[model samples]
Target: MIRKRKHVISIGISATFLGIFFFFITLNNVHTDTYDIARFSTAGETIRSPITIENEQETERKTRETVQSVPDRFNISTEITQERVNYIEEVFDAIATLESEELGEKENEDDKETNGDRLVPLSNQEKVNRLKQILSEPITESLENETLIQLIISPQDDREAGRKLFVENLETVLNNGVRTENIQSAISEINQSIKYATLNEELKQPLTELSKFAVVENSFFDVEQTQEARKEAASNVDPVVIRAGEVIVQEGQTITNEIYEELNLVGLLDGQRNFFPAIGLALLIFLICSMIGYELYLLMKENKLEKGKLISIIGISILIISVLKLVSLFLTSENQIFYIVPIATGAFLLKLLINERVAIIFTALFSIISGIIFNGEIAGSLNIEAVIYFFFSQLAALTFLTNVKDRTSILKSGFGVMVVNIITILLFVFLTFEKYDLIDLLIQTSFGIISAFLSVVLTIGLLPFFETVLGVLTDIKLLQLSNPNQPLLKKLLTETPGTYHHSVMVANISETACEAVGANGLLARVGAYYHDIGKTVRPQYFIENQMSNRNPHDFIDPKESAKIIISHPYDGAKQLKKYKLPKEIIDIAEQHHGTSLLKFFYYKEKEKEKEREEVGQIDESIFRYPGPKPQTKEAAIICICDSVEAAVRSLNEPTEDKIEEIVAAIINDRMTDGQLDESPLTLKELKIINRTICGTLKGIFHSRIQYPLKEAK
Candidate 1:
């Protein structure tokens, strides 16, 4: 028993781990990257944010432009400014000596030879062109002859003196910062300084032009200053905050590049995988398994479950979950019609094969799992339509499939669940308030109906497999065993017809009493049908099948008769095992009589011993049927039922009181004989069993009305 229990628990834990593994594999597969088609999505389609997004790039752009202003960079070339004044001074000195140098040359031979190119003593204006060509700027053709003649003799030739005067007045005034627009203003400032300088009139004009050249733009664009300003500007600007539920794009709006990027940022696009969703899924799986474990624990505590039955439940759940996963394979977020999955199949099967309460709980869990599985576009997000449709339809199936013992009942329940699914889908659509076309509604409703029929089909197809593989003794199996045409039953009837009739009577008595005491009445009835099969092996030896008054025990030793009687239970059990009957039926054949003594044969032996005047204590084992005792309530009830029926049949005029007395005596004997001790029936249950047995027996053996004697014709 301990080993069996350990194996059961080990199988349960393995099932839990297998469930976890399948869920994990499915979840990982479910986390499909949303299609990477970065196209403009229109508003009519529903869009969900698959991940949490923030404004990283937007915040960076906004914050980077808040820089403040700084002073401009200046490039002051003092040497270049000083060189300008000296070049002007040298030009003036060259001009003043030019006339004398020409007079001294006096038309020399080299001058005569090069007369075409250099013999002419040009005008002061021509020298002005010469001077203007020597200097590209600060000299022009429009200068006055007086200004040019003064420019030739000016004595600001001392380099330090000329540079200091240009710096103190004209240069300082011109250097304010010369730009294109400000060039004339800088020239005017230099002229004003020239008008006030302590220099010759000839030097003033030339000095003013030289100082104008000295002025260059002192302040220029500073990158450091501009960057600082931009930084300040960016800092002063507010960050673009994106809240958790912020709408990146709304329905019916065209998805622009920016919005598409926003969707990607939020993981709503096929950009990347997020771990949090997997974590949440794992937690959900944990909770689901925990709930299943607790329910199984309760079932074990109630002593209502077996290891094979638990494995059967797990097998069905996995089958249905696999179906859900298969259905999920074709789904996309755009295709939210996941309501078409036949979730009620599992619920109906569990309710019928195992139980309804567990089915209902599993329905809720299965709906949630399907919701996640079919919630394709939104990734880990729930598909409300799937959840509502599955939950309501499964609930409907479980509620209606109870006591469904016929094909018509199954069809009726299937149709009922289909209707419920349709209603649920319609109600869900209404609650969502989304506009749907007529074709869309029709298609959805059609799938919902198909889902219901499909579930029923799966249940029907899988029922036989469960029964055969798990050794489950459902009502249908029991009813089939109860049929009069079964091989063992047919043989029993042919070879031992009286025992067959007596067995039927016991079936009637036991089935009713078993039901009244909350035992499996079908099992009891089916067991009673085959319980006395051993009598067929030696029909003449057993009293029920014997047609003659003379008994076989009359010629045999009393001990041999006792052995023959005691061997029947073992023979019946062996025959049942040979026929591969279910353990329940075999147990009934083996244990219904328990260790009860063959008192008639055993007393017969005692009588012979007394006749020889050698009576001694008879070995009780020789007179008793080999038994492990009645191990279940149904077996114990069958023992009482068989005894009551036989006792009632023997009475001359059986009444309610006589039936009660016989039933009470049978129950008391079984109890005193330790036949029912192994069964878990309480004292109160035994009393209830006695009352039920007596009531049934009284009805079967009720007194009949006496009639006037008529002549036999």
Candidate 2:
């Protein structure tokens, strides 16, 4: 069932990793500019990149601006055409009025012959000459002699018809608005209309000449207005975007230098989803899994592997990996130095939750993977620089984390990482032989130190979340629980003062013994303090809390007394669980005494059995505490410390020899009863534990010089 549950969790977590991988790979895999406008690269040819490329934001902006600048189209204005027709009719009217005045003068010439004072009237030839002179400047500018003559004079018999034909033919020419390029076509149309008109040959010829002058370019192109209209149109145009996986140069198309450069820009010159990226991704996953697996194997060899610890390790690793990938999405040419990424963060978190050895593994993992994430923008994925920088920072952090015991120690570790990061950055700059500018060198190196500092900051902020959510009993958590202000400890101190004092002494002994065996000393200390909490329920019933001369056990039956004493470990476990104390503390309460017998009460029962004259022997099992022997090294140490402290404190005058003897005796008793059999501790460690306990006890009970007391002060 446990193995199956692990598989289920693995599957669930792997699915999340796959999702992150998809997002990470797809984000940088952009394929742009696939259109084949010019006959370029062949469909079968492999395209090669000419240069490194990045998104052309500026080019895109310009293209969009040009598109927005497209001008609105205009048609020829009918108003200009109509105004030209009205002016042409006015020219003919001036000719007709002159002709009519001349005819009237000729008819009145006979009547005015006698008077001889009348104004002289011009002849037909003279009138024509006058009309030609009147229209010369404007007509000469546009036409030669024949067209100008037709505008100045109309034939007498067909004067109105000629004017009408001229107007109608001019309308036909102007109707289909003319521009400079098509002005000749309008001229041909005008001549055809005049040729087909019903008029005399003389009138028709003048009207045809007038048609040539009728049409001029009315629809002039406006450069400024045209540009404005184009801008408005271009403003509404969407960006001509190219998606990833688009074919930039199609197979069998001839490749151009421009196309090659475009392909290079999007990293698509070689093909879709380059194999190196995939291989790099795979290598990263395999390396991380393999290294972590080896660590777990080593832990398993020592019987120290816990599933919860393994899960937390994997979860923290994925978290840092995801964060690095997320940060990479923001990387651009202006910010190629991904020093903002706190590469040491995973190392710090791992060092806190796991150990330095595992943290070193994480350092390598985070650095290598981060290099992979930054491959294109930086030097390359799995860059030597990244490895060197991260390794130095992480190694330094792990150094400070060697025996980390509190939150302040992590801050100390951060300073250590920063110092190492500074040194690494300086060394890197030196190795490059000043290829980089002084400003860039200082900025990048500063960012390296900042990465270290920020990693520490993030670690501190996230520590509580991991501890609370994952139920990880880190040294800091154990230290927090060891405080006197803890509610459970406070209750034990006030309600069962004797038991509390006993617990404190036991804590001192457990810390010493556990430290000697390379076990969790803080955990043992905290656990020892909270172990006897059940005594608070009926403090006076326990011998330690019985200050009065009379004993509560004297009133109770022997079996009942044994029951009360055995119930404390179990009852304390219940209270710890209800208060949501760490399992390690609760385990100490549950299993510290294991199933050891309450011999005093059992013997007292035997004596009562004799007094009652009972034949059956008193059951030995009935007097024993419920058994589930010490399951952890820390719990076993607490058990030994709890028994040794109580017995040695009972000594009338404890010497070093007596403390040694008492410590050995209690350990031997525990081993004989098989209480230590299930624990991971061996006889070798137990011997060391014995010496440590003995030394601690001697210090507590050491002889002091006697002094006579003053009568009063």
Whole-model lDDT per candidate: 0.73, 0.73
Candidate 2 TM-score, true structure as reference: 0.63
Provide the lDDT at 151 for model 2.
46
Tens digits of per-residue lDDT for model 1 on 567-606? Answer: 7777998998898777778889889888887788888888
The weakest ten consecutive residues by lDDT in model 1 span 65-74
Estimated TM-score for each candidate: 0.66, 0.63
Model 2, span 1-713: residue lDDT tens: 47545654554455456435533553343222223333353556544332244446645677666765564445677897887787677667768777777778877886787787566756555655666666545553555556545544556657777777667767766776678888888878877866877667666776666666667887767667777777676666555444432345655777676665566555554454355545555555655655666676665545445555666776787677777777767866455466666867777788777777878876876676666565443212244665667667777887876556778878888888888887887787678654788898779778877888888888898888777777766778888888899899899988888999999999988988888989888888899999999888878888788877579899999998888888999889899989888777888899999989888999999898898999796789889988789988998999888888888878888888888888888899999999998888998999899888878887888889999998995
RMSD of 2: 21.2
Candidate 1 matches the true fold with a TM-score of 0.66
**Model 1, which residues run further than 4 Å from truth?**
1-4, 7-11, 29-49, 52-279, 301-303, 377-380, 615-617, 711-713
Query: Model 2, 638: alpha-carbon shift in Å?
Result: 1.3
For candidate 2, the 10 contiguous residues with the lowest summed lDDT are 29-38
* Candidate 2 positional error at 405, Å: 2.2
How close to the true structure is residue 511 of candidate 1, measured as C-alpha lDDT?
91
